[model samples]
Target chain A: MTRSVFFVSDSTAMTSKGLGRSLLSQFNVTLSEHLRPYINTEERVDILLNDIHKTHIEDGDAPIVFASMMDEKLMNKLSQGFAGVIDIFRPFMPTLERLMDKKSSKEVGQAHKVGNQHLYQKRVAAIEYTLATDDGLKTTDYDQADIILLGVSRTGKTPTALYLALNFGLKVANYPFTSEDLPEFTLIKAHLENRHKLVGLIISPERLLSIRRERRALGSYADPKAIAAELAALNSLFARESIPFIDTTTRSVEEIAASIMAISPT
Target chain B: MTRSVFFVSDSTAMTSKGLGRSLLSQFNVTLSEHLRPYINTEERVDILLNDIHKTHIEDGDAPIVFASMMDEKLMNKLSQGFAGVIDIFRPFMPTLERLMDKKSSKEVGQAHKVGNQHLYQKRVAAIEYTLATDDGLKTTDYDQADIILLGVSRTGKTPTALYLALNFGLKVANYPFTSEDLPEFTLIKAHLENRHKLVGLIISPERLLSIRRERRALGSYADPKAIAAELAALNSLFARESIPFIDTTTRSVEEIAASIMAISPT
Candidate 1:
């Protein structure tokens, strides 16, 4: 059976959608998803309520509403009319009030707004640094890097670097170990100079072969034999240098980044 | 007085922290923030509760708790002890039940578990495309891009492009306008070829001047006169070519990206 799910929020609806999707995925059911973002107005909420009621009647079931509305009056109105209204914000406000001994301001759309100029500038700078130092393109600024990620080609280094930069406001630089730099004991000059910031990433040969094949079909880069050899050499190199490495075979970029952060100084 | 706020979650605590920070920022108060992630155990909840009680006695105010726990027993235990417990998830579950006419799975940490392989691969491929075509580096692949952002130096083009790629899985390429390309009304070869995918970004001269000054202390790039001339010329060029442009002076990267998505065909 198909169930309708609506993610409603005063801002982007990203958080609502994320949490809703996660919870819904656990059930053995197909979902028809709808997103209603920037729903800060009473009129907008009314329109959404009408739509929800109509969906409920037409589908012969109540349409589930995942709402992150911060306004108390609007939320109360929604709860009164919709039986399936999931208030994402109100349940937390009373507890916060008792703790701080102050009532919440009940403001909306403040989470994703550019509130702090200093923090915003830092994030922008990190993004710029990530782009500039990507794939070891420019090594002159290695000293400024917060962390450096090294991995073989197509081993999930670039996405990890960008994730670190975006999420944590970190200046992350990533380098790839090409075939020419492999099968030897010595490290590259840049890696040697910035050994302290090095974090290695390695993937299983089977996974690496498939990823490489997607990028360049019918090439030795995707050969299982070559991939196995490279991974073995790289593993030894990481062990020799005492560099921490993670296998990205079954991990997401977030998992890989969190692991790197936990192990690395950055 | 300093108020303490704890963001407790059974998973990454990202949603709890995001919404909590946004709501708390509306009040003019000093807050000591803490995040307690992966609080899935009864033992862990006991420790958190003890910490909250101690903070309350020490500060003479109860500590604010923003929790997204999915476990009913743990949440009940928390509410019984913590006067300031904000239940982030449970309040919405009942409404969801009535709407879907089914009980929730009540699972945790599933929102960002790399569930869909196809979507994950698409996001990775988009990131690669964005890095490859950044700052007009590889115009040969412009035909494959979903969107192209154009602006003068430091008009918030790169961050917007990266945000589009990271958030929406869109292949975004950005180009900066230089003085050499100014004064004449003719479009560049690449712009002429992919005019349909183009989205122009314009910023206020004062803001542009300051941003450029931050990058280069004393150069023509940062000069107010140079910024004014470039912005005027770029505006006329966009008008002449009937290209859509957004003013990035007051908008956040998220706002700018949403506007671009609304207007762009992609």
Candidate 2:
């Protein structure tokens, strides 16, 4: 029987879901996954318990719950009714508490709470900064950017930049380099100055063709020969400039962002 | 003495960081947190151990490590050297293995790996769709949207929409509702047809003024009286039309997205 897995939590269930997905990737099993968020109230808890019980009874296998709930009462109740309860926080909280000689607040949804308004506001400002400088607009303010991405059109630049800005609170500015700009390949003043933060992104010509063609079914934009020439020029330009780059052809945005974050100067 | 906490992992260190931050938020301690990603190599692990040992000796307290490493050899070395090793994956792995009657893969960074190209491509497509429909552009294509966010200026719609699309793989289309459209707050045919997917977003006049003024130092757009009237009219429009709205005055993009995800019919 296929096990039904649940990522349940008092908050957005994101922490539970992120960690749970990672944990489950290790196992060889056929399972259905569901996210149960905002499980703070007893009423919500009761409803979730009903689902877990129903799934277990129907599937003939106890449903496994990966929970990040903070409330003691809620957790105990859940553990009592569900034999497959796996605490996602592990048992390290007590060790940490003892080591520090302090008690845990045990509050729910503390991770996502806007406790520090300054940091939160800075994140919002980073989003604004990334958006205003998107697609090479307003490059005069590139000095304020924490990172800058350079790539040709449809090379996964905008999503990667916005992901960095949204997730890591980094002001990312992405400039598009079209095929026309290749013959006289010269860096703009902003890019030349912020060369330390420059990241080049490239995609395989075949994949680029598919992606671009999806956007514009007609035109020389998705022409195969032109795409190959453009990528070759981009590769040479990156080598000449001694800039680090990532190939997005087979990588997820998370993987690309992680590589960039690991190599980011800041 | 302050604890030098490290979120160490073989992959992006995001899983370790996300869960570690939540676990640490429970405790009351002064933590100098560091994210150590891509520690998949023995040389990298050696370098990380050097930092941990140095912090332990200098601070007269062992550095706490929250590791999500999947390699059995690396985890063994780490646990042997450090007394404060906290495995973020916990003891559930063996249990899950037994439950599933299968051996674990023990692979690194599997969560972020593009194992399913369809899901990965869908996520990228969602990002593109969100950008193409950002700020009310291409409204005719709203029929294909998974969710549509309606808001006045400076109401956190664009960032929220992008966050939903990028993180959750939702085809989010956001349309701007300016003060000029207050009296004539009529839904276009596309939005009217997809009214079930519409989510109205609002911000307090005080916050709106501050945000708009940050973009433009002087303008009737940031005028206090105008901002108040705009919100009041928008509220009545939402009420009359029975459109559920989210107040984004103090919420983070994650928070707003969470609420929407929980309430979204789709």
Candidate 3:
């Protein structure tokens, strides 16, 4: 039986923006959300109770409740109220307090200060790179790029790009392909003639379907036939362009980024 | 023969501080301190002339010079003064201008305006994780970190950490081990036993010595024997603690980070 978890916070906690969703996908856990900024603790408790009232949680179902909040009294109340229904997990709060205390004792070095500069430059560069071209592949801003990434959506483009930009001072740009761009010839023509170095990301059809289904309701777009076709087309484009691609179907974004750097020009 | 080119920029041009040194290491490049803000064209030209004079490149040692500048007149003066000696490479200006122009036209997206709460929370959590204990593994500050990087130094930790914090909305922190910590296993033991997820970074002894030599001119501490001993100790610590580490002697900070994500706890 899979464990069901609810992540309740502002909009940020709802999305796997930085905390590696691809890595989490491997576990048999399902995460749902109820997030809003203005809702106070009492309001949140009410809403959560309402959600639980509606959810079909069986007698033996395991559910975890994760929250990021500023209210202590409300948290205590909710914790006491939902002790039986959920395993309340407040993950980031303790982390924040510890960081505040540490900063008070020591000053970061000049070298580390320089690292922060690189991090900022990379992010600015990534956003700039994406805005530069329509296909999201070409960039005359080559000198500015610490690193540039190219691939399809849900193949770990944004996170990897942000990781490089945010974590390694690499300016990264990524572009997604629409269904129209899936034809073998179109893929070849769009990405092949470019002089910029390209890295391809390929995912397993099953994983792609699962991700797509989660994005919307399960539909034709998330069907196996469409996924297989896209994967096959992606393979052909990678081959024709001589661009080395990774099968991200089972790998984490960190792995993909690592592989990209192993072969990057810089 | 490797090409020798000089990169000149002032404070603003020197994005993320110490990266200039890394770029210099990667390329046969000479970086000059001509990048100063608010200076007039005449002074800028004088600085360029001085850098050229100091190098004693008689109009043709290397035909290209990369300068990040805002003054067109200064660039023209530089071109005329040196003639065959330099061809200025101002990579950021054109892109910067284009981006500025495009920004006015962009329709802000819901995602952009929503402020990625999750990313912010995760960052806070990561910072808290680093600072929760007196373990010298990580350090953080909002002003200091942008992103705090937790790892042992010489693992490309300094550069990668800086790049992330400076280039993006991140704060980075890094720590290094001294010979005193080599024989003692207490630090590593306590770190692992406490469930602290330590990010270990390992580099080749030879490369560590070479890099240390560049930073500190031929000190006894940088000798091969000392470096080898320290690296061996680090390896043993990582192994015993079941810490995941990467060999980063040959890789750049970007590559190291990519690899870190690939292996880090999801």
Candidate 4:
């Protein structure tokens, strides 16, 4: 039987899910996660308390809770009943409060709203910009881009760009390196003006061959020689243009985005 | 004059950043944040130690580090020199270890790679599917979609859809309800088969007006009366069709997505 796990939170940012994911990964347990978000009011808390009790009864095991409650009274109320609870945020709050020389607002969802609405807008706008500029579509607005990624087809330029935009609020425009810009070893003509922001993406020929073959197995698109030449040329161009590049061979999108942010500050 | 802060981790997942953002928000501090990712070795730890030391000297304050290093030896080594380090994951480890009756692998980054590469591929495919089906372009894949979003212009369908696809690896296809289908009270012609997966997104007319006005100042597109009628009709359609709906007026994309997942658990 799968253990029932509850991700309880006062704030509505899916905090418990993200916080619990890393912690829970350290364990080897088969769990069914229930998200109880916006757990602010006494009424909601009462419902959750009952839900947890029912879950305990039904599962025949005390349901584990990963909570990030901001309210002290509400947390106290829940703590009274739950035996297998881990207050995820409470462990860190005391040190933070002491360090800042201030008490937390204790108001639900206040921490995020302080200066984050602007950041929220930035992310939404970045998503739009990334989509509009995907695969080198809109170069005229390259001036407004935070970073530009250059790569050959299917080297994972689009997904990486969207990840940066969605998670980091960075406007990223990605261009697939074309064979036309070849021989001269230039990446792109007009949009290379954002050259300061340009970063190249590279993948192993073997990996690209397999990925391409997955879509269509008939063409030179999956040819080993063609893929190898394309990569070698791209590497030469990256070196000649003094552009920083990443090998997206084994890295996940999140890892790639993090590496890009570290490699290029913007 | 800003305090220096570092998000230290053996993870390449930006664990430190995500963990640090939620925790640091509880305090009142002006800080410059540094991401020290993929800190898997003693050599890397030595470099980080040196960087932290230099930062302390330059800032005239011991740089605060929010660490999630799984390796106990590396954590001990870093703790020996740093005064302002918070071991974010240490407190919960004992309880988890006891509960699971298993020792954590402590092999850096192994937790995520377990069955998550398939999840990563799911996300990439979801992103592609969401893009292809966005704004009702490709309806043949309705059978393959996890959820279908119905909304008018600029109600935050595409962003929410993309967020679900990227973060949760859920394939979401969204279609804008056209005024042509108004008299019949049907949402879309061909996609009605996926009505069980349909979720209508609503927004305040005033909010929609302001948003639309930002794009173009003139036309019925931004008209308040027009927007009001559209929303009223959509709500009626939601009631008549018995499809679930969400109000995106005040919610951030994260909040909206969280609410949608709660409202309609696809």
lDDT of 3 at B127: 30
Q: Between candidates 2 and 4, name the one with more favorable lDDT.
A: 2
What does candidate 1's lDDT look like per residue over A1-266, in tens digits?
A: 88888988776676677667756755646677777777778898898899998898888866778888877787778778887777766655665566566786767766665345555577789998998898878888888999998888888787888877876779999987777765654577877898999988988887888888988877668888878778888898999899988878877676677667656776
Residue A75, model 2: lDDT of 88
lDDT of each: 0.78, 0.82, 0.46, 0.79
| DockQ class, candidate 1 | acceptable
| Model 4 residue B55 distance off true place after TM-score fit, in angstroms | 7.0
Q: How many backbone clashes can be found in candidate 1?
A: 0
TM-score for predicted model 1 compared with the true structure = 0.84
DockQ of model 4, rounded to 2 decimals? 0.47
Give one digit per residue, the lDDT tens place, for model 4 in B1-266: 36688988887636666556677666655568788888879998899999999998988877778888888899988988787788888898888677655686655665455446677778888999999999887988899999899988888898899998988789999988755555435655555777778888988888888888976778777888777777888888899888888888877787778777877767
iRMS values for every prediction: 3.0, 2.1, 21.2, 2.4
For candidate 2, lDDT tens digit of each residue in B1-266? Answer: 36778898887788887887787777655567778888888788888888999988888877778897888788878888777888887566887776667787987777865345666667788988998999999998988999999988878888898899888789999988787786657678888899999999988888889888877867678899878878887888789899999888877788789889888886
Off by over 4 Å in 3: A1-111, A114-119, A130-148, A185-190, B1-266
Candidate 1 residues B134-197, lDDT tens each?
Answer: 8877988889899998888788787788777876789999987886676643567887899999
Predicted candidate 3 versus true structure: per-residue lDDT over B1-266, tens digit per residue: 33334444321222211223222222223333222322235776687577666554653343334343335566567667764322222332233224223221211111122223344334433433333321244332222333223333344554455343322324444556777776643343334343344566777777777666755656656788877777777777778766667676655454455455444442
Model 2 accuracy (lDDT, Cα): 0.82
Off by over 4 Å in 4: A1-5, A28-36, A39-64, A72-82, A178-185, B1-5, B27-33, B40-64, B72-82, B178-185
lDDT of 4 by residue, A1-266 (tens): 46777888876646677657677776666667788877887888789889999988888877778887878888887888677778887788778676655686655664455345576778878999999999989888899999999998888898899989987789999888655555445655655677789988999988888887876787667788777778889888888888998998887787788789877966
- In model 1, pairs of residues that clash are none
RMSD (CA, angstroms), candidate 2: 2.8
**What is the DockQ score of candidate 2, to 2 decimals?**
0.58
